[model samples]
Target chain A: MENSAIIQINQLIKRFPMGKGEFTALKGINLDFGTGEFAGLIGPSGSGKTTLLNIIGSLDMPTEGEAVVLGKPISKLSSKESAKLRKESLGFIFQSYNLLQVHTVFENVEFPLLLLDYTTAERKKMVMDALEWVGLTDKVKSKPPQLSGGECQRVAIARAMVKKPSLVLADEPTANLDAANSHNILQTMLNLNRELKTTFIFATHDEKVIGYLKRKIFLKDGLVDHEEWINQ
Target chain B: MKIAFKLAFRNLIGAGLRTWLNVIVLSFSFVVIIWMKGILVGWDHQAKNDMEQWEIGKGQFWHNQYDPYDGFTITDSHAPIPNEFKPEIEKGEMVPMLFAQGTIYPQGRMQPAMIKGIPANQTLLKIPTHKLDSVTDVIPAIIGEVMARSSHLEKGSRVVLRWRDSKGTFDAAEIEIVDIFSTTVPTIDVAQVWINLETMQEKLLLPEQATLFSFANAEENRPAVGDFRLKTKKELTAEIDAMIKTKSKGQSVFYFILLLLAMLAIFDTQILSIFRRQKEIGTYVALGYTRQQVVTLFTVEGAMHAVLAAALAAVYGIPFFIWQSKVGFTIPMDTSEFGMAIAPTMYPIYSVGLILSTTLIVLLTTSVVSYWPARRIAKMNPTEALRGKIQ
Candidate 1:
């Protein structure tokens, strides 16, 4: 089955101005990820994978062409509108675990919902539910500093899923973890994707990370070098 | 919003040493500004008080200050006291007062001093109310403690005083010291003598109404009695305050410039902070925070530091003001030109306006002083913010 497209990019370009010249980061690219698909964007250093992720995440404006996610043409949204969309529809996970270090595991998971002005009781329920999904309900009171690598990644996963967004964008989420920790975190994220049918998109250079995904797109020097599907 | 505050609080603790250092610097700046504010206002108050009491409204009032001749006639014709100015002299508030240089001869010792004669009814000179009631004889005098001590003369002891009379001529008299008094202000308490208005009129040998005139106290609550056109202490103070205002014309601009300088420093610190923790800011952005949300976090962080510092200062400063209010601060007599007779016993009058205005200034200074860097952090592209960290 070709899972229905959730994101589409076409003729995308990004340029940077040096003192007297311009450097092109993304010359042109075309790609698509289907609904409920676990996908990885892989590239070498300076290959512009992170740049592509930023554009797709609505964290940046594209210099040219179209990058659309979840039926929203991100480039067309005003800054405030774009921010609202991200808050309501997207989740993010980062390599550093990005759990607010001062908060307990429960608070870290509940942090995004706080911005939504949910009542305390609702927040508790949602956060606990997310923690359970990550097998971290027992560590709800623990701060990030107290957690091991695998547990920290689990907390990050809990935070992302707590918002219950349609899509999750992760940038090098397992880059800081050991091999076993990376494998465990990937399995946990894939398990959540299966249960919730949420789309998961990753920008990474790790072969181990790429192997877990059902779809893969590889970029070389800002151009799409290959796009493939596995076990479909 | 709660997450913003929580994150801000966390950022402060996460960089404990730097946060504390900012607090210390901020507190020091607060103290310096407040201390300067107190001293300037204190000095102006002291100056005005002395002026009203000593009969020098704006600057020194001259009983013929410009006239080279001694004891010149102040008639309605020759050195005319303006007819319009008469009611001021007639009223007790601006009563005619005279000054003359004299030699006081106690036995064989003679010392040169200024003898001032003021109306016994006028309380603006700070003659104690109880003592005013006790002054029964017109020819008796209030001699400075320094003069009395030097002369070895007690109250009721008679001494000879010689001076040039109102007509540019010489005159002499023998009078008893009715009161020997001292003021913390050294200028007035040393080398001086005070006599009743009538006594100095007699000694200076002037006609019944000859003396220089100035308003007693402009800050007083008294209504205007008549055409008393004497310069009020308030008018004099207003002039002086206006002059200082002109001197400090661009103070707000200077404050802004200082705030800018402070902002630059804050930016350097915050940028260094952000640089040192590049991965941290990147992590926050990646974790679903908008640029505005990030800015709000840092700005609130800056405000918290400012408030914390001000609160600490207030904790110490309020009690200091209270102690100062009850006991008063005594500036030494020798420190000012006004002399011991005019020394100020300053009691700090607390005003909520002062505290509130000062706190706002400090908070604004800190926030404005710290905003540039916060914007820098907020405006950063996520790629640049996460540049070195994602690999």
Candidate 2:
């Protein structure tokens, strides 16, 4: 593995119990992702894109192989260790923009930092900066229910990027957005990736998301079929 | 832990009426349990205090043969008053009483009764024994209200009294009722009559003899008299203690049921919260919380309802309890009908220990019920939960 590689997978297999039989979500697959890469796992639903992303994010473990994230084996990490990795190094974005509905936009962005031991003043400054990046400074006190779909997704992005984690796993981040909103979100993520050098791995089949990725790994039936790199 | 508290507080506050509804119900339990327990404590104190004042004067010494429960023993119960108690009696700290089996005919109806002779000038008990000092051709006597009602007799009414003297000879005389005293202690009130000690000693031809002696204060380390057994205040009130214990046991079941109703509301709310907040659970997991941490968060959230309820209870319960302590609680039924020392109106007594212990019990029970349902979060699949799937 190169020094720049932040995530490395070898013969990764993920299976779930279906009735009395086992259903393979991700077949034996090998993949590597380097730092500062804007990448997406492109495939239809149930093609193991999310399964693989979950494995890399340390939310789920590989069944038959090793998934190393930030030099920690995903399959071997204890629950506490996995939580620590997620808290300190990895960020996750969901398709539905899973902002804490009862919390203000500022509180949602401050969630990840609360897991760490940041001073209150440090957290406040960092949250304001992240919200400013997403152009949501005016909506800090607004709760998710009071915001539009586009604004909610922006808050989710601010929350994921608030800690300036080395890796961010976004799953179908644009699936619930309109075309204009999707473009706006993708452009913001792209600019953050270039400026902060933060590695982003997205599990999405949305063509609009695909058009903005620096590299695309096409997955077919739980296998990597092809890979493409786009010129900036 | 700090973050858990913070988030739990936010979640509880955010839930709005659902949270307050459970809190109010639990708060009602807190107030009622404390109030009910206070009434029992007050009754216990009142009953014991009344017995001390009206009947048992701190302690007593009984002649070995005297048994208050058996009327047959009264005929042989009297002896010459002990010389050791003479000084105390002269000092007005002790009073001697004599007892004998007797019969009364009121309105041509006959009834069995006990005739007691107490010093007319004694102040050891609340009874109006001075009424017996009336000088008249007919002997003056005092009886409790219950005895008066049973004999169809009233003040100033004359009744024929017959009794066996120490020599076993029957004597009869007409006695004038001097007074009818009301008392909570049935032992002092029911089926009894009182007369002047000097007059009774002369009538029975047993001068300077008494059946029992009551003292105004407990005397510790006193030498035992040869023919009498000393009874401390605690020993004298043992029956009342036993009765209160039995009553307290019955009361426990009521508070338990009351707590169960409140706990059911909290448990129901917790179960509903877990079902409805799956996505929030998932979001917490994705935000770097372990499943156990999420369980802790939910448990804390549920437990916080009790904290809020306690505050709410104090808001109203303090004033209500204070006012109750002053105004007292009146039993709807006649207390005299209960055939016990219960007063018609009982004032509740509140102690810090009682309030704190009750609060702790309810708080612990609420937390347990809350945690019982929240444990399910630890087994949830985060991936599915994030999608808002029912697990």
Candidate 3:
């Protein structure tokens, strides 16, 4: 993972203001995520998995040390540079199936391509292909509110995969679904990762998602407790 | 920016009732503001036209001592009609007018009146001076409806008219009301009577003398007449212009309140929408929009309300404005008392500039109003916003 790394983090630390005092969320973290790796940060509530994922997605900056993502130092990236990195290369899926409720499944999926300046026809094809990959082609016209939990997650997945981004950061992607829906969403993400060679990094402690990941980094008390490689 | 507009348009449409509710209120403002301004424009246009035909007649030459505001000057404002204007008056292109302070006793009720004299043969003014040509034993006079109503004199009614001559010799005579004319110009009407210029000159004992000369050839340049000042049509209508300007200023406060309400509706909607759509804003940022871009998107979305409102205004306002133009807006009250050239019913003039300026004003104002709240998004933290947290 280190040699083929698409993300390299060394001695990373993050802090939050806790009413005049500070709470350190990550303590001297060192990690590397190679291309095409289906990995996750496993932790309990408040274990800082989401914070770590957020930093890697360039949504936040590390308070100390270096986080180089796709060769751009996340700690030093300007707001615009970070936005450009996210727009061109990164995709995000959220726990609540953070699909734009008013948008149709197709529109939700096409959102990323709209930012990439794809032609309308190209966007249409790309969105359709991504929906097909998620087995949500039949639900293209349905809005997120009209879909089942599993269907909404798949739409979220399609949105994440539409641009074929180099990285997909999903935060507790299955936290709101039932067991069957959760497994279905994981299987879809797993298949997408394998076929597109896109790296998947999720922040979750769910067993269903943990079972599908080939690599897992366990966090306890804002520290990496251990890491294990499964099905390698 | 184009993509922002597109997205904003989609979002506004997607919001359904919320968007339309705001748009409808704004559209109402659009119609009303345009309509009110149009009425003022129409009134100005009509007043100028009426003054041109009934009173000013291209322009007037006023006696240097003649101030319409001062009654003391009326006794001395009279000057003998200049020799140079006599040819034009003979050509029926100019009319000499004389004014005198007089008293009329109709049905035993005394009323102070203005005695205005215009040549019976002149075609420059719309007054019924020709009716004065066939004067019988008594002098024939034309009075406006307001004067007739106030003086209680009707056509065929005989009244006593008394006035002082230039020599300060007071004289009295019997006069018959020949006609009671209806006109929009109060300057030519209210408590005033029109009689033959020759008859007025004879009664005032000022032969070949007049207070002013009204010329029909508005374009012809005139040489300086002895002690008389040339008043152009613009200067002549200055009173009406000033009145309309004052009315417009008074109405501006109403317009501001109207715009403020409409803008407040839009501004409130934008601020509320920005707060309610925190997750959506976060989603937008996550999907590659910088916070500033999201702000642009919200601002565009809000400003598009004006565009939508304009279209909505056109949908209903066009027919209303057209109907208003056809039927004219009627003042329920008599305009004769206003002492200005105001008609009972006034048509509105809607110019291209007015419509464009109004739309642009509403748009720019709405954009500014929308932008004020949208600036908050630039400072938002996408992570908290993603969770739909307020702070």
Best by DockQ: 3
Model 2 / residue B228 / CA error / Å? 1.1
Give the Cα lDDT of each candidate: 0.69, 0.90, 0.91
TM for candidate 3 is 0.98
- The per-prediction tally of clashing pairs is 11, 0, 0
Q: Which ten residues in a row have the lowest lDDT in candidate 2 chain A?
A: A1-10
lDDT of 3 at B147: 88
Worst 10 residues of 2 chain B by lDDT: B217-226
Which tens-of-lDDT digit does each residue in B51-170 have in candidate 2? 888777888888999887787788999889999999999998999998888999898888988888999999889998888888778999999888888888899999999998988899
DockQ of 3: 0.77
lDDT at residue B324 of model 3 (Cα atoms): 98
Q: Provide C-alpha RMSD values for all models, in order.
A: 5.3, 1.9, 1.3
Per-residue alpha-carbon lDDT of model 3 for B281-301, expressed as tens digits? Answer: 999988899999999999999
- Calculate DockQ per candidate and list them: 0.44, 0.72, 0.77
Top TM-score: which candidate number? 3
lDDT of each residue in B1-391, candidate 1, tens digit only: 6676677776776667777777666665565455445544554566556655654543223333334134333321122344554575566454555667778888868887677667777744554322423544435677766667777888888888777776777777776777877544444556777777667776676545434555544454443323223344555456547644653455545545544554455556766765665555665565556777777777777777777678767777667766766776676654434432234565444456656776798788677656657777766766667654422
lDDT of 1 at A114: 73
lDDT of 2: 0.90
